[model samples]
Target: MTVILERDCVIAGGGPAGMVLGYLLARSGLRVSVLEKHADFFRDFRGDTVHPSTVTVLRELGLRDRFLQLPVNRLRTLDLVVDDHRLRLVDFSTLPAPETFLVLAPQWDFLNFLGAEGAAFEGFDLRMNTDATGLIIEGDVVRGLRATGPDGDLEIRATLTVAADGRASTLRDAAGLVPEELGVPIDVLWFGLPKPTDPPPPTIAYASPRGMVITIDRGDRYQSGMVVKKGGLDALKQEGLPALRKHISDSATVLATVVEALTDWDQIKLLSVQINRLEKWHRPGFIAIGDAAHAMSPVFGVGVNYAVQDAVALSNAIAGDLAAGTAPEATLAAVQARRMGPVRKMQRVQRFAHGRLARATAGQHLAPRWAIGLLRASLPVTRRFLTRFIGLGFLPEHVDRPVR
Candidate 1:
């Protein structure tokens, strides 16, 4: 039998955006249902950055203390060696107290932490292993969604529906909202390596004419990703895993020994990085946030952070109308309006950053010495900008609405 459930909001995708949105709305005393397609958030190679901006949001909600209880690595610096110039690209240590640095935790651990928090709210409903199939429309208005779960078919009716699914959102497609894609010069290949007894740098990267390789320390393991050209993975794989290992070792000598730990092709995950956004984030009764609204490049490792920030903005924008059981397009547009500026500025910065690296990948040439000189000259000015932009973003949103 098909189960029909009703709530003030039905959110598709229990990702960072959706989960945070669920937690916020439910805390606002509005019944909110979150549909998660995955049985659990155990997928590897996902975004795990918990930036200072997010820390502030959590602190506002009184959840920061609990989140800190979880085992995580707090990285104080972002150091990268490009063209033999060790640039302290970002200094997290420079940020203000109680919010300095970024926390590195598994995406699953963070999601599970949020799930636990949402569970405490009487109005937060999380349907695990449930896939939201399509939107239910009545007279050009998005009323709710139809989903499939372990039982059978499920339909959730609500005053507002949200698409937080991810870069490829079914709900976004169902609503006929298409993203205008920005060109991505590079893709990424993700793999893991055994952490050295003493790591080189917690968050570091090695760049050469070959390409850029980034590594993030996760205690006993180093999660590594290499930037490659568009449609570059298959050819690279055809050359086999040995080529991939050599590629990393050639650029990042610190990872030489451990790069071989990735023995099989199946072990590495490919991320076709893209940056895109919808022309309009909402219709009358439906809205999209996070990656559903904008697909972020992984360059700054801020994808997860930006998504969570979106949740905060969305909750702040529509909490009143949601509680009153009517979310107009203006309220939804306010969320996008609050978020779009940062999103645009960040994407612009990423394009410029990646554009330089993309040239190296394209030509198999070395990192330009002039570019290095330019980077060093700009460091005096760029340091503050990079630290703030990458660590907290431009204007972080705070939760001001009172929750029941």
Candidate 2:
């Protein structure tokens, strides 16, 4: 039997975008329902960094201090090491007070935090173990969604339906939103090795002729990723685990002994990173945010944070309309208009950096002397630019509607 539910807004996918919007809009006193395909927030290989953009939102909501109690780490500087040369690329410490560094909390911790906060609001309704199957449309003006949960099928009708089901969004597909793929050449083979007993660097990457292996300090373990050619995971696997182990060990010598811990191939997750954005983020009563609207590359780990920013923009644009139960298509359009420029600029930079990585991985030698020299000479200028871009983002959102 299909369960019928009604709300002002129905959000598919309880990810950063969906959960944030659900929480904030409900805080604004709008009825919101967030559906998650999974039963629990725990997931593997999820984006773990909370960029300052989201941190600012938490501060605005007065949730930052409480949220800080969760298991978290700080990444103040991102260093790129090529052969014997090391360059500090993006430094988060340069950011202003109270938001100087990126918070490296697991995505589940972040999601659960959002879920709990949303639950505190009387207008918020969160349903887990629910998979959105298709959009509920009435004569081309979209209305809500039909989902399958543990209990049974659920039909939710709302003033606005948001597709946050990620890059392969069923709602986006059902809505016929086409994406422009920006052909990224790299795929990531992500796995974890034991964190070195000694103090580890905040975030470090070892780029060699074989490829690039980045290791982020995940408290007790080193969350590692090996960047290989697109569709290269299979070929790399065919070479066997020993070959994979050697590559990782070479990239991170401190983990040479630990690399043997990965005995089986299944432990390594192949992330086919795709960077794309929809030509249209909304059609009528439906809106798409986060990965559904624009799938980002893992180049800079900006996925979750960007999604958070999108939620803020989206909530700001349509909260009142949602409350009044008359969310017009124009308000949906405004969210996209306000956020697309930043997405385009970010993707352009990601694509350029992607090409550079591919070239560097295929060939030997570090970045050119002139390039390195330029980076060194312009450290201060570049530092401020990148710190702002990654930390606060292009257009940071504030809590327009805070619950009294």
Candidate 3:
């Protein structure tokens, strides 16, 4: 049986972009529906770094106090271990007070918090376990979406359709909107390690002769990741689990004992990194946001924050049209135009980082010897610039007015 529904806006994928946009639109009194393929937001090892810009957005939405209630680990500074030298790359403390640190929490907790908060609005409807299968297009213009859930087939008619279904978005494919692949040369193998009792410095990355391992403190355990060449997982499997563990141990000697927990291959999850963006992000009655528009590399952990920013920008740009039950045809281009600059700038940074990592993985020094000295000499100036760049981003989006 087909269950038909209508709304001012229909969003496919209840990710950061979709949820935030839906929440803002509904809070503004616009009827909005968000579809989530999963039954719940319990997925692990997703992007969990909530930057200051996102915190500011939460504050603007009047969710500051509630957001602080969630279990979170604060990272004020990011340390890097390059061979025998320790470098302080980023210092968030230099940013505005109170929100000067990065919050590390489980992605699900953050999503659930947003979901619960969004539910209070009467116009918000989040349909879980609903998978968007295709677009409902009419004469080159999208009408809504076709989806499947526990009940049966579903058809949604809306003034506007948004594809936030991630990098591998079905709706994006359905709309024939392909993202231009911005080449990335490295992937990451994520695993868990026992946290030290004494607690070491908040060192986020370690680069040794063996390889690079990124460590994120999760209170009880460390969510660790080992960087490798792109499409290199097969080669890693050939080297065996012990070799992989050895590489991780050699990269960060402090985690040598705890690396034993990864005795089975199943424990390590591979993150195939991709950096891409669409030449265009919208059709007549449809649009795409977040990873659907651009897939970010896990360089500075800015993907989630950027997605949230996109949502905020979209909400600020077209909430009036959506509230009036009109398709935001003209405003769709404006949204893309407003966001493309930041996306392009960040992607350039990611590409540069990838180049450095690729060279490092091939046994080349991550940076020149003299360059390291220069970085050390300019540490103070560098941290300040990086703080604003990473924390607030190129152009931080703010809530225009009280949505409620």
Count of clashing residue pairs in every prediction: 0, 0, 0
What are the models' TM-scores? 0.96, 0.96, 0.98
lDDT of 1 by residue, 48-104 (tens): 889998988888888888998898888888887876578888887788888987899
Q: Model 2, poorest ten-residue lDDT window? A: 359-368
Task: Give one digit per residue, the lDDT tens place, for model 3 in 1-404.
Answer: 89999998999998899999999999889889999999998988899999999998988899977888899888889888887688888888888876888889788888889899999999999999999999998999899999999899999999899999999999999999988997889999888888765667788888755688898888778989988999999998999998988888887888887888888988889999999999999998899999999999988899999999999998888888876767667899999999999999999999999988886567667888898889889989987998899899998999988435
Point to the candidate with the largest lDDT. Answer: 3
Q: Rank by TM-score, descending?
A: 3, 2, 1
- Count of clashes in candidate 1: 0
- The C-alpha lDDT values of all candidates are 0.87, 0.86, 0.89
- Point out the worst 10-residue segment of candidate 3 by lDDT: 321-330
Candidate 1 CA-lDDT value: 0.87
Q: What is the lDDT of residue 335 in candidate 2?
A: 86
In terms of lDDT, model 2 sits at: 0.86
Cα error of candidate 2 at position 156, Å: 0.5
**Which digits, one per residue and each the tens of the lDDT, describe model 2 over residues 88-185?**
87888778778877888988998998998888899999999999999989999998999999999899999999999999999999999989998998
